[model samples]
Every structure is written in structure tokens, then in C-alpha cells.
Target: MPATFSTLAEFRTLLTHAPKIDAIALGEAQDRNGQLTKPPGALGRLEDLAIWYAGWRGTARPSIDAPQVIIFAGNHGVTAQGVSAFPAEVTEQMVMNFQHGGAAINQLSKAAGASLDVHALSLDVPTQDFTQTSAMDEAGVVDALVAGWNAVAPHTDLLVVGEMGIGNTTSAAAIAHALFGGQAEDWVGRGTGVDDAGLANKARVVREAVALHAGGDGLDTLMRLGGRELAAMAGAIAKARSLRIPVILDGFICTAAAACLAQTQPDALDHTVAGHASAEAAHRALLAQLDKQPLLALNMRLGEGSGGALAINILKSAVACHSGMATFAEAGVSDA
Candidate 1:
């Protein structure tokens, strides 16, 4: 698929017209689920998950064999405000760790049989401090979005987009606060193990940034308050929707990025499911706002797609039960 969007307005138009899930296939999957050789509704959410996945793949029986996990890393200029416990250089270092397959995400993706790819979005050029200016200009945001759009490989049945950026939680908080109309304190949290004082400072930074750069449309808000990694995640999610690939969203930062799309087009996130809820205090609130119930909640706060990768097995099980189970008629089992 062509991943080029020359401008944010053009992208917005595309989002407005993104394809809907296959209702015919969804109906077929529901009928198939009814014929499976098991008690009705015994599989619970697994049954629902299977049907949802089938709708996106446009198949009555869908299998999640080609799951792709992409990690986008970028340096954050807001780290200059001491918003994060780690330095901005950690973004590049962690990208190297991912490349070397030493990160938690790498291990989880491998265990889940997913193909992992890491993209560092100009690690040397951190985004501008949103407290003073927009994080990225129109051209820059488009470039980042295009990078994410092209990162997704063809024939990927499922997608998980993660992020690595110091001070990004601050960016995510600002985006959430701006888009959702909440107090900065309500949106900010201790990211990367920041202490009480650091958390307070993070909230203050979010307030300042939102005060300066709020009230624009979703894409504009992203260009103002979102980092490259966040924008890239949004781009990838949108791309997944365009390609009819189901998405499993990660944590707070990833959710915040996806929330931007929701703010743009309310139905833009229909193809996605919350893979896991992060330990971030605002994640649950954000998920509630998005009405996405997470598939897992292990009190995980680690980013780099660790939680989403771990949840892949859950999706695979759902798919397997949906596709691999023998129908009552096929098995010569009594339906009644």
C-alpha cells in the first residue's frame, strides 16, 4: 500500500473515509461460533474476540499467524524539563537494545511468534519542547507518520505499535489532557519511576504545554504536544485500519496516540483492541474514555510493546478456538 500523505489535511480526509469492518464476515463468524461444538458462550470474550478479528480480516474463520510488532523510538526535548527519570539519550540506547534483541519487548515478541521491527525516528533530533512551541511542524509530523505507515509490512494479520521516548509520558499526558478536557494533574503520572516531586513537575509541564498548545484538531494537537514516536504509532494504527489489519494497542502512551485518532474520527479505532492496561495511573482513565477494556492487566508499566506482545498469545488462543474448533455437525455431535 502507498504510505505517503503529503499533508495532515490530506491524512485527515483519509481518516474520515477509512473503511469499515466487514459486516457480512462478522455475521458469518457469529453463525460459525453458534455451531461450534461447545456450550454456548463458554469461551466468553474469546468468542467475541474471534468474531471481531474475523470482521477485520474479512474472513469467517481468521488465524493470527502473522503478527507484527513495531517499536518506534524518538528523543523528547521535554526531557530538558526533568519530566522523566531517564535522560533523552536512553531512547537511542534502548533502540540499540531492541536492535540487539536484549529488550523485554524482544523476548515477548519472540515468545509470541511475532516479527519485531524497531524504528528510531531521528533519535538525534528530539522534538521541540511543547511548553514553548509545537513539538513538530507539519512537514516533520508527516515524515514521522509516513515512516510509521511504511513500517508495517504487507500481509500482516495483526499489528502492535510500541514506543521508546524519554519524557514521552509527559507528552502523552499533555495530549490526553488537551483532547479530553481534564486537569493536568488528572492526566499526568509517574513515568519511568519518577518520584513525587518529579511527578508534580510533570503535571506542571503538562499544564503549561496544554495551556500553550491546546484546542486544535487531533492532528494539530499531535503535532503540537505529541512526540515523533507517538505520532508514528498513530500513523501505524491508521495504516492498520486502512489495510484491514487488526491492532492490539499497548499502554498509556500508545493509547494516548490512538486517542488522537479517536478524537479525529470517533470510529477510527474500531479495528483495535486494548492489548493491556499499563500501571500508569491515567491509562485506565484514558481507556475508559476510549471504552476499550484491556485484555490483560498485569500491573505492567514497561513500554517498548512488552504488554502488547505478551497479550498476543491471548489473541492467538482466541483465534485458534474460533477457527480450529470442530462444528457440532462436522463432529457428528448432538447440537441439542
Candidate 2:
């Protein structure tokens, strides 16, 4: 669907008016779960996952037939601060790899039967270093937001938004520290295999950036400290909430993007679940702040929505068992 709003103010208004889950579907799904021919709580979290997913899809017995993974790539100007192990050129190169189906996310998406789409946001023109000024002005951030908003296909039943921007971990750390009011080291992590010295430098950069761009609300914080890809992830997540599509959030950077939403509106992430707790050291803490329990935790930290893509199968299995299993009467099984 086309974007119905453009500016950040309009976007914030859109968020305030997002659709809520289908309560009738939730009730019916709960009723069906009770009669699924299994002992109570036998499926553990899967039962809850199915019910939550059912409410979002507006069907008591819903299947995830059309899962979509969107990867948003952007070059960050913060790499100039030596905050990343890899250079910015890799962002564009990785986009090409994703296009060629050669990246890990491509294989994971295919394995989970999800269609993949990638949007590279202005690779040649990176965001401002942000240590000097806000990473993006209102216009730049809005464009990225709109890009993410329009990228979600209206027919998609399940959504996963990922990022492929170098130096974004620093941006994530800065955003987290700014929003959560923590020391910089508390939120910084070794991203892209940076060395110990590089890690310290990364933390320092986060501290300085957050100090410079402190005291803004979620959207202001995003515009000040977040890159285009980060803003885009936030945008896609908001769009998913508006369309009532259940989202499987990726790792730390993705969670940081989602954090902007949570800070903006407490219930903005009601439709999203943590796909995985990544190897990123602070990801667990970030997930905790969002009150999201990840569905998987394989010590995986390779981004590009790889973790979320892997989780599609887990959600699929939950829905399959919930919707496809026969009730006790249908199976002629005695509940007693």
C-alpha cells in the first residue's frame, strides 16, 4: 500500500492511530487452543505465539503463507570516526550480494519460504557524521521513513525488517544510551568483529554522540543519532503495526530501531516479537527493555535479518500445529 503520511509529525499521528489486534480472533484462538487434543501448556510458548499471531491476522486459525523479509541498507557517515571494523563501501557491496542471493539472509529466507526485498538508501550520500550535527535533518529522515513505510507489501502476512549499514551498531548504542539514560559502555558492543581498541573507540563515539544530541524524544533522537537504515527500520515497523502484520524483529540494531517506536508509544510494538537474541552483548538488555522474549537464541549476530528469517520456520510450526491439529472430539480423544 502507498504511504498515507509523509512528515514525522504525520508519522507520529499515524502511529497514534495504528490498528489494534483482533480481540474476537484472540478469544476464539484461545478457545481453540484449549481443545487442541493436547494437555494444557503442552506447546509452551508456541501456543502463546499462535494465539498472538492469530489476533494480528484477524483469524482464529491463521497460517503464515506470505512472509516477507525486508533488508534496508544505508551508508553511515560515522564510519569516519573509526567506529566500524568494515568500511562503508561494504554496504553497497552487501546489497549487491543480497540481490544476487549470495548472502546468508538470502539462503535463510529461501529456507523459510520468505520473499526478500532490499532497499539501499542513498549509498553515495551518507548521513552526516552526527558527532558534528544531527545525522539527518527532518527531510532526510522523513524520506528514509517513507521508504521503509512504502516497502511493505500490503498482502504480506508476516514481516521482518533488517539492516545492512556499517557503523550502525554505534548508532544503535548511541540511541539506546540516549533513550535509556545509561553509560555509553552499557550499551556499546563489538560489531563486525572490531578489536578491543576499536571497541573502546566505538564506545567513546557513542558517548560523545549521545552527549551532543541529548534530550530529544524518540523521533528527535532517531533523527539526531540514527542513520537512514535505522530510521527506515523504525518506519517499516510502524507500517507493519498499521497494516496489522505481525513482525519478527531481528537483532540489536533492529531492536534499537524498534526501541524508538516503544519510546514513542508504549504499545507500538504489540505486533512485534523478538526473532532472536543475537550474540551482540547488549541485545539481551535491549530486548528486556522492549519486554520482548526472543523466539530463538543461537549466538548468531550476522545481520541482514538472518536471525529473523530463521525464525519464520519456528512461527510456521507453531501456526501449523495450532491451526492444523484436530480438537479432542474431532480426534475422538478423551480429555479426561
RMSD of 2: 0.7
For candidate 1, what is the total of clashing residue pairs?
Answer: 0
- Residue ranges of candidate 2 with Cα displaced over 4 Å: none
The sequence of per-residue lDDT tens digits that candidate 2 reaches over residues 1-336 is 778776889988988899999999999999999999999999999999999999999999999999999999998898999998888999999999999989999999999999999999999999999889999999999999999999999999999999999999999999999999878999998999899999999889998998899786899999999999999999999989988999999999999999998898888999999999999999999999888999999999998999998999999999999999999999999987
Instruction: Tell me each candidate's TM-score.
Output: 0.99, 0.99
Per-residue error for 319 in candidate 1, Å, reads 0.7
Alpha-carbon shift of residue 64 in model 2 (angstroms):
0.8
Overall local distance difference test of candidate 2: 0.93
Q: After superposition, how far is residue 142 of candidate 1 from its true place, in Å?
A: 0.8
Residue 323 of model 2 has an lDDT of 100
lDDT of each: 0.93, 0.93
User: After best superposition, candidate 1 residue 124: deviation in angstroms?
Assistant: 0.7
TM-score, cand. 1: 0.99
